[model samples]
Target: MLRLAPWKVASILAVTFLAVLLLVPSFLGTATVDRLEKLLPSFLPVRPIVLGLDLQGGASLLWEVDSAALTHAQVETLRDDVRGKLREGRISLSGGIAVLPRGVQVRIADAAERAKALPLLRALDQPISNAIIGTAGHMLDITDVGDGSVQLLLTDAAINDKIRRAVTQSIEVLNRRLNESGTKEVNIQQQGVDRILVEVPGLQDTTEVKKLVGATANLEFRLVADPGDPPNEVDNLPQQQGGQIPVQKRVMVAGEDLTNAQTGFDQNSQPDVNFTFNLRGGQRFGQVTSENVQRRFAIVLDGKVISAPVIQTPITGGRGQITGNFTVQEADNLSVLLRAGALPAKLTVVEERTVGPGLGQDSIDAGKRAAIVGGVLVVCYMLATYGIFGVFADVALAVHILFIFASMALIGATLTLPGIAGVVFTIGMAVDSNVLIYERIREEAHMGRSIISALDAGFKRAFATIIDSNVTMFVAAVILYLFGSGPVRGFAVSLGLGILTSVVTAVTMTRMMIALWYRYKRPTKLPI
Candidate 1:
């Protein structure tokens, strides 16, 4: 246990040097880090510690999914599906399809058509997987009411599945939107079944963040309908400027087919959003434009008509542009929304808060004081208790703290107030393993054992106890991380890492220092 190889010493020194190097950027100013980034080699990591929202101060938003809007959209889609199925089967409806909150109903005039429609509509009952039992359930429940009426209702399982899917898609869309807008270290997570929690650090504009996340950004292309078109075939959508425009209900191309979108200047030097479509959308767009030359094409976004232009010629290049008297920022925002795609459902702001930097600085100061006081007390107690060996332990404790922060910076983990508490708590625990070893060594020396024999036996015997205690603490940290959220997770990370670092510095590092001391001085009596 007292043996120290030359390779082992080299490795420990190398790791210590790297830890110090990795930690340098955390103490430097942002401009200094930027300058060093250019001068340093590409392989060296210059990443500084990332502060959490509570530390850096930013926007905190809680959004809830619009269940009513989702239901209405789903029912509208079902009504359209029912209409198509009846038309395809050559079954005449007595009246128009009636839309419900969660389903659709249609009445067929003839009994024979009803029987044919019953089977046709039943075929639309999609098979969905039951997540709880791992069984299959139908998404739509088809029932034959009295007379020639048939009702199709959406199942509870289907509604819940759609809500869950919407929440997941919304998170992904928000992540992409925020990241593209250059918002770094943003935290977006699912709070509950229908709510999302978004915390963005260092956000300057809360309104822009809200706008970026709130807009549904649903984009569609429809043909401008003439006055003679059927009522069911046209929809009067509000225009962005004013008034209303009648557009065909059948979408010529949807935003889903968009492959890329970017902000650019038009021929008139006005800000505009340029977009490209995928293969299928390109073919459909070309076909529509070729068939409807000189007709107006209306661009609808979120149920509002943004622009309508006459199709002079077929656009076969799969590219298009939208110009709507937009400023530079508006054009950029539109491009970002288009590129991020549309949210599955509308999200309303349920709660909003902004943390200021003053509070964060106070938190930092408080944490610093707690850590410094705790570390000083530990250093004094160890030095007074174990003398020269305590100095070795103090050096190891400092290295242990360095390892914790360096590892966090290397992995880009955010540090919160709770994380600081975790680190402070770790300061007390860092000396426990050393105290145990020292006590064991003192007991062996009192038993008339030689100095080297006492040191070796003490380390070998105390190592098991050290491993057991750290293992239990590490397991608890793992559990906390798995089950907790946000700040709790931050605490778990620091505590877990501190356990590992404490083990290294307390056991290996202290033992190496003691072994080197013994080899040079050949002490007649152990220092305890």
Candidate 2:
């Protein structure tokens, strides 16, 4: 029919080159692997498929904020604020307490004090919007108290809102930390306002992860007396060594002025943590050190003192180091925590499940089995029905898979069981375009056209139909991707990519093959 064109030969070569460039490096573990993995996808292939947490086996945590406790705490804070204000105003009252859901309430002790208390009470009575309020004569009552004291109630809506915000913030912080930790494919989501789900696939040290999650990273720098220093008063000094000794009090700085922190080894080959401060922090640290040379400053992290070093002189460079007993890993983790900043809300572990790598291996084995069985069956059916054309279709289909895998490896998209299934389905659906074109060719050949003429007519007539069908499916896949989450999106992605690749291979590659065959054999009669 048609001879293989130079452009088709070039295309095949290009695809082969791309497949090797994109996919072959994924099997390599050398120094160039990372560089290759990043560069291959842009010029060569589609995004890579990453394995999901379930397949890789790491840690999944479902955590719910104690909304009731949060509400109670908020109300208590409000109550304390009111109490402090009242005490400052020198007002005396019998009962004025803030409870969850309902705001604060203040009962006037005497009728004479009504005027004084009303304004204060009214000022403090910032209505918890959406809370039911009851008024009986001079008494104001807040109804809907979900938990805690009956002074003010924290509403369900308020708790839900806070939980949502907390979850969002927590995810942001966790992402930052995970990125710094060099972990990939971390999944974090809000199950509800109060609950968060975190999945870290391929993470081994759950204990370390738990530590990072639980840490608040509220760093502080305070002046502490060196245990080896002399007492403030000579008579008050303990003669013994390593006793609590009072060194001159000095304030060098705090971590609030810190802009960044990193882990490094000191000149003496000991583990140390280093931090850089902003202008403000630099200025403060400079002033404090200048004023109190030889005084010790303690670097505190999450309420524990990590190091206390004496100021020998004013450090104007705005950089300092903390030396302590630390392993290389601990130092690195500390640096990561400091750099990632702090979490908005404390993450409490409500549920946790861990999967071992062995299980993940089993899952991979099972997925491979399913894929092989399904693929072989599809190939057999396609070849049986379409004969030589079907075999051509099969070759194109295999190329599609290679391209898909190459794309996935290039992009680092995690592969899951669902994702594997998506790929398998893609293979089965990839033959549709070939089938359409082959059927059209058969019809044209039956109409008594020459082999070459019939092949051309078939491709020309079937192109539009192939486009229309694939376009419709592509649109549906887009919709599915838009509405779907997690695994559903994986399926959409695979199907969408498959459709595009199938069209190209079926119309373009199949035509090239037919041309090459016809040119070689010079077949006067139709193969159909």
Candidate 3:
């Protein structure tokens, strides 16, 4: 152990230097770090440690997917599809399609028409992709209603699948919206079957964030129905200006086809949202406008008609503007939502809490005190117990802490309150390895061995025990990270990182320090 290679020594010094460099920004002010980042090399890290919501103060919002609204949407869509299919097949229905609680039902008095309509209706049943079971089930269950009616009900598997999709899509949409709004370190994840937990760090006021996240932004364009149009084909949707407007239920274009949306001013210099569509939507839009010139089309957003304007000429440019009584902020937010696309389903806020910066600062101060006290005590104990050997361990322990923060900064890990606890706990753990080695060395020296032989034997023999203990602890950290959520996972991350750095500092670095000391001092007696 005393015969340390030149390359190993150089490598150790290089790593220590790099760790210091990596941790530099964490201790500096944000403005200073920002300036440094601009001046520094692109490959070098200048980003500061990201604090968690608990540490930096922000909002924690728990949202629940509106299963009732989701079911209503599905049933409504199914009803429309059934109507379209019956019309496409030229099959006559005995009555209007009946909307059931879980599905839609249609009666066909003619046996021949029922047989013809059955194939077209069955074609609407979508196949679900299940990872474990492969192509497992269909989205719809088609049942014969004994008499002349056929029922199309949503399957349990389909409902579950829709909920999962809604959660996933909501997360993606929220991420895009919040990130675009310059909210940093926004943590969004699925909490349960139908709930989402969103943590926005550094933003105490969550009103805007909540508004941005909750808005469904489901934009649709439909032709204003003529007075003579059938009641079943027209829907009297509420208008933003007050009262209701009769519009055709068939959507001319939807938000899904929109490629881009931006806040702009209309010809009247009023705040509006300008949108551009994709190839398919543009063609369909142009066709609708060309055929229905002089007729009005309603721009509907989240079921409310924002505007209903007469189409004086064909809109073949694939671009349009939505004029509404909107403020600049509203227009901007609307454009953002449109650009992000609509949520799969409505999300209701079930729980919400905001952490103020004052509380966060208090927690930070408490954590700092704990870490400082723990580190100082450990340092003092080591020095008083082992003399010069203790100094070496103390230096290594400092480097170990540096390595922990450096690793965290490199990986952009957020530090939380529990993470601070983990760091303090690791401070004691950092010195434990040194204590074991020092005790082992004392035993060897008492056995009549030379100082060099004792030191070498101590590290070599105690190595296996150190590895075994640290390995088990590291495994525990891994399990905690895998199973735990929020702050618990933060604790696991710090603990895991501390274990790794401690192993390096406690074992190899300390051994190297002792080896170098002995090489120069040529000590006849041990320091301990």
Candidate 4:
């Protein structure tokens, strides 16, 4: 057990050097790190653990998806499609269709047309799944509801499917919007049904985040339906900064055609969102502008008119600017939204909170104090118990701290206040395996074994107990991490990483040190 090969020596040296190497830069100031980053090669490892919202200070926003609104929109679209289908089939109905519970009630003018209408309505029924995990089924059912009346209603599964899709799509869009803002360390995830959670670390102001995430960003270009129509003539007019603006129902250019959007100053140094279009959008935009020379075209976003300029010449370059009389920040936000595309459904803030830097500093300072107090006590206890061997254990404990932080940085784990507490808690536990081994060695020494035999037997006997206990705790940590969120998740991650590092330093490093000491001095008696 005291034997050490050259390769084994090299391996141990390499691990110690790496642990110290990864940890050194973390102690340096940010300016020093930046200078070194410029000077160093690309392959050198120098990353810090990302701080959580509690440590870094940021915005926490809880949003509830308007799924009921999605259902209403779906019903309206279905109603329009059904009406169009009936008109195309030349089916006559008196006073149109009445929307009823679970279906549309169409009262036919003639009883003879009822049979014809039933088949037509059935033809419009969409294919959908009936069961949650079953095969495809029909979305609607056309039933005869008394004399000359046919009802077409959507299936429960289809309505539910729409709701689920809306929630998922909203989350995805939120992620894209935040990502477009060039923001990092942002967490956006689904909370419960129809709810989303967004936490942005290092964000002091919530205004930009709220604006970017909440903006529908639904952009469309359409011609003026009636340039002379009075302002009060429109009911479905889009709401804008001034009021509702009337635009053609037919969309000339779609936002989906947009490839990029960036904030830029206009010729007059006014802030504006400059946008580019893809190949398809460019063609359509060129055709529309060329055909409608001297006619007004409106650039609309989220039902608000952005610009309504009369076409003087064809714009074939596939690029344009949206002038909304916006502030610089507003223009930047609009550009971010335009680049991120549109959310499939609307989102409303259910809860919001802002974490200031003062609170975050307090958390960080408290965490530091806890870690220092816990570490110093552990070191003192180990030193007092086993003397020289306890010194060895303390050294291993320090290495465990290095390994834990390095692992966190390497794995990109977020560190919260609870996570710091976890690390500090592990400080007390770091010397556990060594304590067991030393106790076992003491037992062997009391049994009259030689120094080498006692050391060998101690490590061999203690390893099993160490492995079993660490593995059990590791499993619990995994379960906690998988089930928990936010601070709980941070705690689980720190605890889990600390467990592995502690096991390594205790069982491996302490054993190596004792073996080296035994081989070099050739002692007859052990220190413990």
Q: What TM-score, computed on C-alpha atoms, does each candidate reach?
A: 0.62, 0.57, 0.60, 0.59
Please list the residue runs of candidate 1 whose C-alpha ends up more than 4 Å from where it truly belongs after superposition: 41-43, 61-73, 76-107, 111-165, 168-195, 202-354, 357-364
Worst lDDT run of 10 residues, candidate 1, spans 178-187
Residue-wise C-alpha lDDT for candidate 2, range 1-528, written one tens digit per residue: 355669778978698678766776656654566576466542344333445666766787887766656566666676786687667667776665524354465554555554564455446444334224432122134332322222434444555555666677877788777644221456777786578787776655578778878877766666665466566522222212223433333334656678888888888777778989899998887777787688766666665666667878888788888776887667877877877888766778988887654346767898889999988998898889877777888888888888776666654555556667878877776787887888898899888888888889888899999899889989998887667655676667677767777787777878877777777888777655
Q: In candidate 3, what are the lDDT values of residues 387-444, reduced to their tens digit?
A: 9999999999999988988888887777777888988888788799988899999999
Candidate 3 deviant stretches above 4 angstroms = 59-73, 76-105, 111-165, 168-197, 203-354, 357-364
> Clashes in each model (backbone N, CA, C under 3 Å)?
0, 24, 0, 1
lDDT of 4 by residue, 420-491 (tens): 888887777778888899999999989998888888899899999989989998998898877765577778
Ranking by TM-score: 1, 3, 4, 2
| Over 4 Å off, model 4 | 28-45, 59-73, 76-107, 115-165, 168-197, 203-354, 357-364
Error of 3 at 309 (Å): 39
Q: Candidates 3 and 4: which is better by TM-score?
A: 3
Model 2 / residue 340 / CA error / Å:
13
State the C-alpha lDDT per candidate.
0.87, 0.69, 0.87, 0.79
TM-score of 3: 0.60
Off by over 4 Å in 2: 1-8, 28-49, 61-161, 168-195, 205-354, 357-367
